[model samples]
Target chain A: MALGEVFLIPTVLQDDETALESLPINIINTVRNCQVIFTENERTTRRHLKKMDRNIVIDNFQWFTIGKIEDSILDTFSQQLQLGKNVAIVSEAGCPGIADPGQFLIAEAQKINAKIHPLVGPSSILLALMASGMNGQNFHFMGYLPVDTTERKNAIRKIESMSINDNCTFIFIETPYRNVPLVKDIISNTKPSTRLCIAANITAASENIRTKSIQDWKKEDLNYLHKQPTIFLLDGGRQYAPKSHY
Target chain B: MALGEVFLIPTVLQDDETALESLPINIINTVRNCQVIFTENERTTRRHLKKMDRNIVIDNFQWFTIGKIEDSILDTFSQQLQLGKNVAIVSEAGCPGIADPGQFLIAEAQKINAKIHPLVGPSSILLALMASGMNGQNFHFMGYLPVDTTERKNAIRKIESMSINDNCTFIFIETPYRNVPLVKDIISNTKPSTRLCIAANITAASENIRTKSIQDWKKEDLNYLHKQPTIFLLDGGRQYAPKSHY
Candidate 1:
């Protein structure tokens, strides 16, 4: 049981029924059987659960830990799983492998072959790109940027270059406050003609989808402040090649 | 009212109740709220409605022509909408924007502010990318390729170069039988190390999601002669740049 320190569970964005239903019945079943459950924020999960009010046995658990990578917290989940006891891994929202803490636990789960399965659901990132009619086939998902100023700016430059140089849709997330500066960097750094699709407050009422060439942006576009959740989709301006036929 | 013509409605590739419920409401409230609905195959929609056991009001107009565009069908839908009567546009399957008749209507709609609102749902292309864990932020969905050899080879070149030059995922779909040869061209024509992720039988029991470097593919990899639905995801091998700040 390689100290099944952690097990992965998924929480979807919004209260989207589609995303909730997309979870493999097996994973949910497993969670129901688990002895303990760990969430980034147990209080939020408990409140959300109470509202949904489904008859599930998984609700009661010896809940524990600070949300982010607390070393002792990892030990608690890991030791239980390793001992062949079931443990649940929950993100505040969305799929696990995405730009979230679940990745580390997932990698560990993969290394152990601990019966892992990624249940599919509504990814705000994917939803935005699909509707934007930009490149939905090939695009990078470089989770979140580093906290350091230089590294963060460098990551943005790399993304801008990738968008212009190869015509790839470069995607990244910014902490709420960084939204203004990030948008500014994009405006000042990338080619004026680059196509930008910003999906802000996705899956929520404030949900908005705006797309345009960089040069076309007016000051109003920058007014996307005070909004906490946002996903940026940049069109890599590579020339289009005809699709290959038989 | 503008002369409304019959419309082609592809089966949307999702099974979410809220989304389906929201579609008519969204289209009627926002997009052209017209008096009629035309489809390539209303029989299927009727069957779907029966399966869901919902009493949907579908007014019968005329059968839509498949494979060829009918001018008369276009006239009826276009005219009614133009005359300030709202018209509804749908497909027999999936979203209209990807490789379908909807593009023609959508382009026309955009030109006239006939208002196009593409709702979010399960797209085979996006689903494939999501499962592959490859690039999702930037990708080029080059619909279907032209079938001529010289032109197709040229198209492959464009796909290959984009991967190497920009690192965007190149997504393509082929008739079930042609996937093997397409893989051969990608392997022979591009760098041997390019990564390829092909997801066949997506969202179904016989689903196959396989990833292999170009050089690692064996005769076995090309052995599938599946008569199943497929979406091919390929990594054209774009070089990652040295870190830079945006």
Candidate 2:
């Protein structure tokens, strides 16, 4: 018996076509062939499909809403695969499995020995890291900081310490509305010379990416980041000269 | 005077169009508009550009080879930007500025206040992580481990310890020819129950992504990984039950 294959698809970061264009042509063909679709938000997935190909009949496929992974949900997936139904996991933004509920579906697929395919697309975290001009050799992506003020401060301190000690770049994102406060915390809590890269609006037309010292950032106007999706990066370690003799 | 712009472009992971197709269409247009290009490897960049668009007059554009960073190279970049020439940085594989020499160029651009644009494409590290079904929220990409036998063992131990202590996924790559030995070291050193995800030949037709326990992997033949580009992931931490009381 043939086992059902699971495709890990990627979506655009913003609502524009520029980010969507990054997807390979085969992804659209893959969408056309899938029997069942699992996504965080069905409406956005439909919209993305429509943009990919206006000819795609959105109602022809079975759509499943991926919520918290429960045992029943795992069973449902297994039964579908047992029936040889192809499954595609889509996310609301960027790659499905990263920082989303899609990983639960992937974990189930892995346990059952299903063939998994990961398609490529825009990832805001990687894009931000690529443009940040910071240390990329070693880096940490801390999805989001704690919501509590004290805990968030402590987390920021820990990130700073790690960046300096490991010679690594630390990356973290925040809730859209909390961008300003997070920047403020980062600027105030870290060392004066710590390098900070604030990448906002990602693939959008208003994209802003700049790397500056904490001291320099403190002197700039930050009104541009209001209510925007952003990724923050810090490289606190002192720059090593090209070579040093032992 | 308007400053020159710098574009960070991604290349195909394999010598095929499947990975290249993930790049946005604007990347070709960006290439057409740029007067100068700085690439890690000029031959590969030329081949990629030709593949992106056959009609592109490759001779019309000035090409610069990115060598080790030094004062003269930095001065050349500044001079080009000062002349208001749009520049593009191309990598041999994946996105430039990440695990490539392009980051140094980007850093120089940022220093001169040049506009930087990061286009979207396939990144094997991120793609592997997205498919690993492991913890994506907290992860580290350690470019490569030490080559010495004792140091390599210690590094593997430390990675496992970090995974268990921080609940973070540890990712690293090895030289293509050394993959088999690295796997052996990982299996012999880590706990039997530690989960390891080996993703090899990503974005290629022969791509393989599997997440298995060290014990299970030890039982299987790993001769397939010889001389292949692979991403290794260790999630030694216990899988947290879906719910945990605060």
Candidate 3:
């Protein structure tokens, strides 16, 4: 008997055709091949699946939430795999299991010796890195910084220093609402010479990616970026001269 | 007039429908809109673009090779953007500007304040992380480890320790031919309990992603994975119970 497999599916970051059109046709076929799914949110998962394939019967497959995969849920998930029922795991946005809650089930699937296939899709971190004009050979995705104001500032300084010392790019995200404060903290804490890349609303119509030095950014009016989903990148290696230097 | 923008285009990792299908349909439109393209390899970029749209006249657009972005080429790239000529940048494989040579051009675009759009596509690193079942929130991509035996072993040990100390996943890649030695080094140097995921031929026909403890992996025969492009992940957090623990 074939062991049930696990498929890691990536969903669109924004709800639009532009983002939707990025997905492969295989995604719909992969969805159809699965009998059970573990998703970050069932409602959004169904909506995305329907958008991919309106003909897909929403009620035919069993759905489970992966908010917090307790031991019991883990047991059932692994059991289903052992029973030869392929399962799909979808995150609320973007790719699952990266800065998301899909890793727990993936770990369980590995333990049970289930085949795992991670389909392709947009990853905001990767997208942000792609346009940052920073070091790509070596980089660190810090996920999110410490929320405490003092800790966050200290982290910014440390990250800046590390970026210089290692010649590595540092990427971090902020809560949408706290985006303004985070940017302010970055500007205040980092060196004036350090290069910063602000990538906001990635893959959206208003998507913007710009690189500037901390000092140059202080002179600009950037309040419009507040509350937008943004990814920050800092590369202190002077790989490329920032606008100020130019 | 709005300045011409830079689009960081992502290409297929493997030359197959499964790999090519992951790219967005908008890529063709993006290609049509661009008047100039800076690519790592001009021939391969032409092949990939032709694969996406055969009707795309390969000679219609000016091609620039980013083998070594001298000051002269950098000036030309930025000048083209400043003149309102949209340009596309394509890497040899996967997404450009991420572990590829496209960042220099992106940096030049940034210096000139050109809008940058990183379209969605398959990234082997992100794909590997998605399927690694390891700590994804805090991870470091070391890119490539040292080639020397002693330095490589020391690097592996340090990476393993860092994974344990920070509960972070450590990802690194190896040259295709050196894959076997790297795997041997990993199994011999890492702790018996440290979890390592070997993801090979991502988005290809023989794609495989599996995680196991050093002890468990030592018992298996995996010589077949040699000479294949692969991504290795090490996470010592024990985020979930290993197969032995289960």
Candidate 4:
């Protein structure tokens, strides 16, 4: 009973295995039957499924490339409506259509009357946002910025300038390998009085949820940066994570 | 041996009952000796415990009140923390310290360095926010707005004027009795093209999750206005939760 035929599943994997295994069974079936699996990293997804003992046949799933990703999504979304069925989109990690590369797909889905169902699960992004408690009122997810030193620095500078008290929040993520460098850039480049939180290896055994001032951070090196997967959340001068600085 | 002297139990009757039963065997007598329960709704909490068929005499149990709420919290936090003991704050209908009455206690606990643990459970606020799709990236929970028309209208106006985009989200609950008036005001006052989403009775039977453009909604009177326990999540804009002109 495939009420919806096409599906988009995220390819990124989280550090937790047991929780990942608890994905909705219907979603797993949809992912298995979909003719095309538009994924950021098809190889990695397949490897993860294999590790989870899910023997899914990936022969028919087309690995989505940047050039064809948009068209494939648009086509599937259109066809699903024509057939009167729903299409699901999954992100490489966390919930789909968020910071993942599926916004264009979701926006298109909305433009056409296609239903977009986002299932709630382990979202490191949301975890960091909720845990940060700095600007939960009105915030924005700017996604990941360019890794080029100058470009990244410029982007951080813009975010820094935009920070206002209790107005809005800006959330972004960084690659695990580049976490250290990104932290260094954030600590040095952002305003000294600004408060920031780093949620590392979120929902894992070694999770580190700490919000602190930029000035205090600059005085020391967070040794854990080099040892784990992490995400950085900064709100110019608002608040820290649950930990007390005093 | 008791890891910590004080126990922070949830408001759930099941939790209190289990604790009451477990202590009678005297194996967990340490838990019985340190039973100064710091509860928010003292009257209701005590009643729930009594209903659980427990005759446990609680001479030491300090059922806190709304007025004593502040003092009791500070004293409990300081005492438990200094003694290197953990005190459990019986959670209410949902997670503690997020847009609920227990926040002051949690904040004071944090200030004094007392360990605060939040267990996973039903949170109407988070549930409604997620179901609304009005942008969870940044959101503000102003509790329940005043029932008076002027104050309600003013609150609505303040939130309605916020920059509408996928960046900021404003969430506030309305009195079930005044839901219709609120909706009417929205239609007449805000932009006709703004988008508004109402999630009613979230996570309960007869749940309603619908987002309609103000222009589209003006055609009918929402009959469910009288339904209590409804949540209004408005993302100001012509696209998200919009204002309609009838």
Q: Pick the candidate with the highest lDDT.
A: 3
Cα RMSD, each candidate: 7.7, 1.8, 2.9, 8.7
The CA lDDT of each predicted structure is 0.55, 0.86, 0.87, 0.54
The digit string of per-residue lDDT tens for model 3 on A56-168 reads 99899989988766787788898889889999999999988898868888988888789899988878899989998888989999889999999998999999999999999
Q: Which structure is stronger by lDDT: 3 or 4?
A: 3
Q: Evaluated with DockQ, which candidate comes out highest?
A: 3
Instruction: Calculate DockQ per candidate and list them.
Output: 0.11, 0.58, 0.59, 0.10
* Model 1 misplacement above 4 A: A1-10, A15-53, A59-91, A100-120, A133-172, A184-195, A212-216, A219-221, A234-246, B1-50, B60-92, B96-120, B133-172, B184-196, B210-222, B234-246
TM-scores computed on chain B for all candidates: 0.73, 0.96, 0.95, 0.70
Summarize candidate 4's per-residue lDDT along A1-246 as a digit string, tens digits.
233433434332355654353243334554665555445556666676565445777565555532234455567656654565544455566555444445445445444444444333445554555445455444556557689999999988887777654445567777777888888888879888776777776645455555667887887767678757676767774443333321
Residue A24 in model 4: lDDT: 33
Quality of candidate 1 docking, DockQ:
0.11
Instruction: Evaluate model 2: give its lDDT.
Output: 0.86
Model 1, A167-212: lDDT tens digits are: 5676677777877777777777667767676777665544556666
* Model 4, span B1-246: residue lDDT tens: 223333323333123332222111211232245445565676665664555436756555655543344454566555655665555454444334444445445445434434333322334555455445455545556566667778777777777787364345566767678778778877776666566767665534345555666776798778767845677767674332212311
Judging by TM-score against the true structure, name the best candidate: 2
Give the worst 10-residue stretch by lDDT in candidate 1 chain A.
Answer: A237-246
Provide the TM-score, chain A, model 1: 0.77
Cα deviation of A220, candidate 1, in Å: 3.4
Worst 10 residues of 4 chain A by lDDT: A237-246
